[model samples]
Target: MRYAKSADGARIAYSAGGAGEPLLLLAGQGNTHHWWDGVLDDFRAAHRTITLDYRGTGDSDRPDEPYSTEGFAEDAIAVLDDLGVERAHVYGTSMGGRVAQWLAARRPDRVRALVLGCTSPGGPNAVDRGDDVRRSLARPAPEGRRRALLELMYTPGWLATHPGPYRTLGDPTMTPKERLRHLVASERHDAWDALPGIQAPTLVVHGDDDLLNPTANAALLAERVPGARLCLIPGARHAYFEESRSVAGPLVLDFLREHERA
Candidate 1:
């Protein structure tokens, strides 16, 4: 575990590994750096990956205040500064994608490229999660909440073949207070007015069957961001990376490579 001080003097935790061009991985709401474990091995083969626990999650210090996506972007920038990375290929999922977009917009000099997955541009078309899903989030993490959440994230075939890192989800170490903070952070995220400013070469990936953010959100992002391309993976859900790595990972790698060569 490594640490960086945000502009506001808040300490954040991050993990760095792999060898090649730097690629920062930002996990979604309610997720920690451990969320990238499934794809890190493959991603690391091509690029150095930096994963972090945002403020109020994982090993990071939690401040008593409402979380904002913009603030999270600042946390990311602080991480980059701490590591002395002048620029990096940025990739984010769900809320992390929103952060990546904000980072690209706010600090274009620090981003080489941007990859957004299972996220939205945060507007009228963005809040597509249904009442049931919202209710699930509001309630405390139940005994089977991990499995239930995974079910909502991945398709049936992927869930059947790979049950996923159940230990990571079911870990008893995560307290209810921590989980609540994550839930609040996720619920409070709104970045609709911030999309038009992202200038990085962008790739938007969304699952055709995603219920959380929906495919329209991806469309909105691609339509709003200049030169952003959208790819739809079939038979996948919110957790496209975990559910369809064979398809998603290669597509992301190809996009990064193409941008790198451009």
Candidate 2:
């Protein structure tokens, strides 16, 4: 892992691997740079993939305040700038997608193409997570709470078929405060008014059964962004890339290649 310093002097942790066009990956809320491990090799085969832990997650710093999508976007730009990467394709999942939207709109020159997976543009137009899902996030017991959260992310069929992912996923390294900060940041995310202004080619991908963010959010995102394409994986859940990367990975690669530059 390598380190980059944000404008605020925060130590942003990032890892770069693979070879080809640069692809910057922004992970979900409380997710570290390794969040894309499942599909890293696939991406590396075609692009130089860079992943980073959001401030307050993994090896990154935790400021004593709430986080914001705009703040995280700046953090991302900081990492890229630190690496001397002028522009690259960006892929964001879940809360990271919110950050990506803000980045593409606020700093269009830093982005080449965009991929938003299982996320929403916050505001009154967005649908909130269900009560059951919210309850699943509460911590009565750490293990049980994690299991509940996993249930919400993947379908029962998927769980039955893939019984070992939790072992590989382990647990998030975020503290309770960091989790709350991330949740607040995600809730406050509002990019609906800015989507139309994003000049990068965009792809919106989501599972058909994402209870946390919902598939409808994907449709709304794709519609709001000019010329954006939507790809809905049938019968998939919120963690589509982890649960079904065999399908989503190829689609993502194809999209990046379709817009790949010489």
Candidate 3:
């Protein structure tokens, strides 16, 4: 993994592969570049895909500073600037989608097209997982925690066939303090007012059954972002970008290509 220095001199770790136009992939809360491993080749075939670990995750530095979606966007900007890429398509999932909102809104010229998957806009208008879902996610048992997440993230059949533990949730290596910081940063995101200012063509994709992020937020985001299209994958959940990749992936690719510069 190569490194880029953020505005604060934090070492942001990123990896790039494939060929063609640049495509930046951002991971969910507390996750690293490893989360995108499942769909890298598909994206690589069309664009030079780049993935990065958020400041406190993977190979990136863990500066003793508070985190915010805005700061994370800057980290992304640092990566693109470090590589001398003026603009590119961007795809973000979960919290990554939150970061993408700030990136697209705050740095419109650096974004060609955008995709937000299984994510929320945060703030007062965004939907929440409710108390029960929150309770399940807060299970104290490690095994129970993993099982609870797997159940919520994928359909029953998908989990049935894939009978093993996966690290699709938070970064296991992160300390409780680091994870809490990420959760706080994501919770504090408020992009509702900023969405209207985004100039890049946008596509908002989500699973109809995403209780964690609540599928309803997809409509809110699509409605708030001018001309943004929404695609809801039936029978999918929070990790739909991976569980329903065959459907969501091509839709996103088509959207990006539709708006590509000649």
Candidate 4:
């Protein structure tokens, strides 16, 4: 694991693999760099993929205080700076997508393109997962919580094909507290009005059956961002990356490639 010092001087943990145009991956809340395990190979095939564990999650330094989405964005920028990457395609999922949007809006020149998956603009229409979902997320990882999370994240067909490293759910390494903090940060984020400010070429991908962020959020993003394309994966759910990597991977790679060529 490598480290980058954020503006706030917090050391962020990240890993770089593959070799090609730089592609920084910002993971969703509660997730660490390992969360991208499902799609890493595909991304690595075409780009130098950098996967990071956000502050207070995974192996990154966790500061005791209120976490802000803006802080996550700064951490991303710090990672890029540490790697000497002036500009690169930025792809984020879920909460990570929120951070990516902020990064593109605030540091337009540093972002070559944007790919938002299963995320929202934090607008009025943003879907909330309800108290049950929130309670489930907040409580300790019960025996079936991981599977339940997988169900909410992906469609049944997806779960059938790729069962995932399910054993990890019970692994001692999982951090429930950090995950709860991530949920808190996500609930507080409100970037709806800032969508138009993102200048980078953007692609919004969502699952038609996504109950977490809802498919409408993707529509909101496409509608707000001029020329931003939207792709709705049929029957997929919030965790589209794990659910339909064959589909999501190609679509993401294609977008990055198209922009790189232009």
Candidate 5:
């Protein structure tokens, strides 16, 4: 993993490999770049894939102070700049998608396209998560967290049948304070007004069975973002990008390839 120095001089850890157009994977809250391990090779086959750990996750530096989604976006852009990439096709999931909205909205020239999965626009349009999800958001028990998260992330039938898809719920890397701070940033994120200004072609993907953010949020992204397309996977849930990689990987690759730089 390589590290980039953010504008604030925080060391942002990231890993990038492969060829073709660059594709940045901004992971969800409380996750590291390793979160994309399930489908990294598949992406590498066609594009240069770069995934980074947010400020407090994985090998990245964990600053003690609070951070907002906008600040996180700056860190994301810093990763791109450190790599000398002028623009990229970005894919963000959950809170990462929320960060992507701010990045694409605020820095149109740096984004060629966007894929927002299992995320929301925030404000009144944002759907409140269920009790079980709210309880486990960032403060998760390593042993049961994967199982618990899977229950909320994938459909019951899929969970019963599949084994490898829901194994990792992230390493317990963040401290209690870091976890709560991340949640607070997530709660305060409001991209409802900023999305319409995004200049890149966008795709909003979600699982019909998603409960945490709800599939309704995906619809909001599609409706609000100009020229954005929406794809809702049947029988999938919040972790569709990982749990349903076969479906989502190809769809996202197709979308990015369609809009790849000339």
Candidate 6:
């Protein structure tokens, strides 16, 4: 893993692998770089894939300061700058997508292409998960909470075969305060105004049945961003990038390849 110092002197932890044009992989809310372990190989096959542990997760430092998607985008920029990468393709899911919006808007020169999966524009314009879904996730038992999240994330058929650890759910390592901070960061994301200013070629991908980030948000994102394409994976849910990787993966790769800098 490599380290980058953010504008606020926060130590951002990031790693890079494979070979080809640089491709940044941003994770979902409250997750570490390992969240992409399943799809990383696919991305790595044709790109110099990079992943990072957001503040309060994995190896990144957890300072008690306020967290925001904009700040996280700066952290991503720090990682790129540390590696001397001037520009690259960006793929972010969930809260990561929120950060990517800021990255592409705030630093247009640093993004070659952009992909947002199962994410929202946040604030009042975005459709949120239902209150019942949120209440179910707040269940007392850790196992139950994880189960609830997994059920919401993937279909029962997928879950039946792929039992055991998935990195997207709550991490035992995160303190209550750290978890709340991450949630706050995700909740406070409001990229509505910034979407139209993004200059990079953009793709908005989502699962048709996503309960965590409703599929409707995908259309909203596609509409908000200038000339952005939208892809909806059938029979998939929140974790479509993983559950339907066979379909979503290649689509994203083809899109990125099409927009590769010459």
Per-residue CA lDDT of model 4 for 1-262, tens digit only, reads 9999998889999988899999999877777887788678999999999988888877889887678788899999999888998899999988889999889888999999999989988846576666777666555656566666767876676568865664113223546676666767887888878888889999999989887777888998898877899999988888777667788999999999998834
lDDT of 1 by residue, 1-262 (tens): 9999998889999989988888999988767888788788988999888999888777877887767778889999999999999999999998889888889988999999999999877656464788887676456666455556666787777668875454234224456676676656655666666677778899999999888677778888898888899899987888888668899999999888887734
lDDT score of residue 237 within candidate 2:
84
Per-residue accuracy of model 5 over 144-249 as CA lDDT, tens digit each: 6556676787777777787764334654778878887788888899998898899899999999988878888888899999999999998788889877898999
**Residue 253's C-alpha lDDT in candidate 3?**
86
Clashing residue pairs in candidate 1, if any?
A: none
Q: lDDT of each structure?
A: 0.81, 0.87, 0.92, 0.82, 0.87, 0.92
lDDT at position 192, candidate 4: 78
Pitting candidate 3 against candidate 5, the one with the higher TM-score is: 3
lDDT of 6 by residue, 12-37 (tens): 99999999999999998888999998
In model 3, the worst 10-residue window by lDDT is 161-170
* Each candidate structure's count of clashing pairs: 0, 0, 0, 1, 0, 0
> Judged by TM-score relative to the true structure, which candidate is superior, 1 or 2?
2
- Stretches of candidate 2 exceeding 4 Å from the true structure: 165-171
What is the C-alpha local distance difference test score of candidate 3?
0.92
Please say which candidate is ahead in TM-score: 2 or 5.
2
Candidate 3: how large is its RMSD?
0.9
Query: How well does each candidate superpose onto the true structure, as a TM-score?
Result: 0.91, 0.95, 0.98, 0.91, 0.93, 0.98
* 126-154 per-residue lDDT for model 3 (tens digits): 88888998899889998898788888899
Give candidate 2's error at residue 162 in angstroms: 2.7
Which stretches of candidate 5 lie above 4 Å from their native place?
131-146, 161-168
